[model samples]
Target: MDKELTSSIEKVRSAVKEELTHYLAEQRDYLTSIASELIPVCDALEDYLLEGGKRLRPLFAYAGFMAAGATPTRTDIRAMASLELLQACALIHDDLMDGSDTRRGKPAIHRHFESLHRQGSMSGVPEQFGAAAAVLLGDLALVWSDHMLHNAGLSHESLMAALRIHDEMRIELMAGQYLDVREAGEKEFSVERSLRIARYKSGKYTIERPLHLGAVIASPAQSEHGQLLNVLSAYGLPLGEAFQLRDDLLGIFGDPTVTGKPAGDDLREGKRTVLMAMTLEKASAPARRELQRDLGNPTLTVQRIEELRTIITETGAVAEVEKLIEGLATESKIAAQSSAIAADAQPFLLALADSAIRRSH
Candidate 1:
């Protein structure tokens, strides 16, 4: 990404963090009567919210507002910041489901709670307690996101308009998550099915709906709103898919220092990503047997991981995915260039498309 675009995104991230800090403080006071012992829960929520994230959803919301010909105000930025809470909800639960131990170079929320239980010698299975805590925390984040959005100081009309998109975004995310979990258990590998998972799970919520939310807040005319949404969908949908594809690759091949997770984490979790699907389709019988034997093995060794990586590469799945990413990146750029998006917003959107596909982590 360009320095200018990076600076803009950082500003949004900083503003969101500031707003989250104030919101969390209010929650601490509001829940004071509920139970003093719940302080740890509140603290965990605060830490997870403030710790680390790309804040891409908020950035997209801001850009979408701009693209719709409105200058974003402080209120607009704060409203968009609510998306981070939603992201936290998804990620916290996702880590638990995947049995991940780390996130953003720190212990996963569930694992964090597990460690706390062990340190204090709390009763009950530590793992079960951790999982329960993570679930509640994730739910709390979801509720808080709704609170943040409604209290973001937008006009009543704008709030109503944004709420529709917000509701659908959450629903789509849950649907996608369901598909993800279901596919993980299935023995079949389908490229089409995997792409559907990518579209609903990460694609729409991450990009298209956020853009819709921002455009709705700007209150464009119906026809103009349609145009803006069409343009954004063109840019967002493909870019979002590319982003997820890159993430799948990174899960298997990226540096732990950069990705902030153990290598082959996705493999151990048995995530049914498109890259894996393609590999399964193209590998030889012996290679297929090897993958089947170890793909989901928690005890898979470093040597085994390397072997899987080699098989995936040799089967040409990596090359195919790279080609797909390039095509999608080009498509997104073309859509941005040809769109009726406002002049000022075009560059940032373009830069985002570039960054989505080109990022290493």
Candidate 2:
């Protein structure tokens, strides 16, 4: 990573944390007597938001603003920080849906609530209570994301422009997630479908939309807005796909300590990622049957995971995915270099693309 880009990302991280702290504190005071029980919900939200994350959305947003030749202000930072809340909502709901036990190496929100219910001897079913709480918490986070963005002091026109991208991003994310969950249970695999899932679920929301939001903010009235958006898409779309591909690799093979999730979690969840789809397409009959049997089995042992890993490797899926990532990465770099984005911002954008695909976690 470029030292300058790294420093800029760190600065965005710090700014987001500060903005989140202030917002949560205000909410805490506002809800103090209205419903004291909700206090813990806020606490959980804070912990989840502040605990551990790369804050990639906001950094990308900032880069987008810079790419559009706009200097950032505190209000811009606050508005950009809202992306983290949106992400929190997505993760909370995703964990609940997946029945995941942990996130960031800690008990997921629903599991945390389940433990609380059990510890307190609460009347209802702990599992149901946990699921319900997680759903509501996730909704709250989504709402708060809107609130933060609305209150960030952008002109009404700017807010509205940004909201268009924001709304589309959310819609695409939900639609993509639905497809992902639906495809997981199907026996057949399709590379095309998997790529579509990646494009919507992580790609656009993770990079393209953020960059567009910033570009809109900076040049809502500029004649070249369309061109800038196209340029950003040129870079963001491919990089986003590469990002998800890297994540697919990490879900299976990454160190738990570094990834903050259990090894082979994706296999347990039967994630229908491109890597899995491609592997399925090429594997021998026996290997395919074994994979189908154990892919989503919750009780897969460590030895079984190792066997699956060997199968994936032997089938040449890993190499193929790596080759794809490299190609997409190169494509993104070319787009970034050739785009009419501000020269001063090109290096940061390129650095971000490199970091996104090359990261271990």
Candidate 3:
């Protein structure tokens, strides 16, 4: 990305962080007023939200709003910032479901609470206590997402309009998550099925729906609405898929220091990603047996992970996923150049696509 685009992205990120800080402070005050015992919950949320994140969802939403030929107010930016809370909800639950130990180099929410339980000598299973806390925190984040958007100071019309898209996005996300968990439990894996899960789980809400949320908030005239959305979808959907594919590759091959997770964490989690599906298709019987034996083994050794990495590369799945990412990125860029996109917004959208595909974590 050029300096200008990079600067714009940073500016958006800063603004969203500011809004989140302000909103969380208000909520913190409210929670403390209700009871001092809620301090840990508030503290954890603050650390998770403010510490580090790409803020991609808000950035996409801002780009989408800009594409509608409308300037954004601070309030508009606050509404965009709300997406981060929703993302947090998803991630906290995801870590719990995947039995992840850490996130961004810190204990996962469930693990955090579990440690709290142990330290407090609280009765009952620490693990179960941790799981319950994580579930409640995730639910709190979901509720806060709605509250932030509703109070974001958009006009009634825009809020109503945005809510429709918001509701749809949430529903789609839940459905996608269900598919992801279901696919993991199945004995058979298909590249086609895995791709479908990717589309729903990580693709749509991450990119397409955020863009649509912004576009809808712009409140375009009825006649322009359908066409504008269609055009944005052309750009967002493929790019979203590409983004998720990049994530999948990183899950297996990424540097632990940069990704803030153990190497081959996705393998240990038994993620049924498209790359894994493709590997199974191309691997020899012996290689397939090796993979099936230890793919989801949490106790897997570093040497074993390296061996699995070699097996996957030898199957040519890594190269194929790279090719797919490149193709989808090209398609997104081409769609971004359409006349339907606001000229000012087009550059940022293109830049966002490049960033999405190129991120290390």
The candidate that wins on TM-score is: 3
User: What order do you get sorting by TM-score, best first?
Assistant: 3, 2, 1
The candidate, 2 or 3, that scores higher on TM-score is: 3
- Order of the predicted models by lDDT, top scorer first: 3, 2, 1
Weakest lDDT window of 10 consecutive positions for candidate 1: 219-228
lDDT of 1 at 139: 95
Which portions of model 2 miss their true places by more than 4 Å? 223-225
- Which lDDT tens digits does candidate 3 get at residues 38-88? 999999999999999999999999999998988688999999899999999
Task: Specify the highest-lDDT model's number.
Answer: 3
Residue pairs whose backbone atoms clash in candidate 1 = none
Give the alpha carbon lDDT tens digit for every residue of 29-81 in model 1. Answer: 88876999888888888888887788889888988898887878889888998
Worst lDDT window (10 residues) for model 2?
217-226
For each candidate, what TM-score against the reference? 0.96, 0.97, 0.98
User: Please, what is the whole-model Cα lDDT of each candidate in the order they appear?
Assistant: 0.87, 0.89, 0.92
RMSD of each predicted structure = 1.5, 1.3, 1.1
Mark the regions of model 1 whose C-alpha exceeds 4 Å error after superposition.
Answer: 220-225
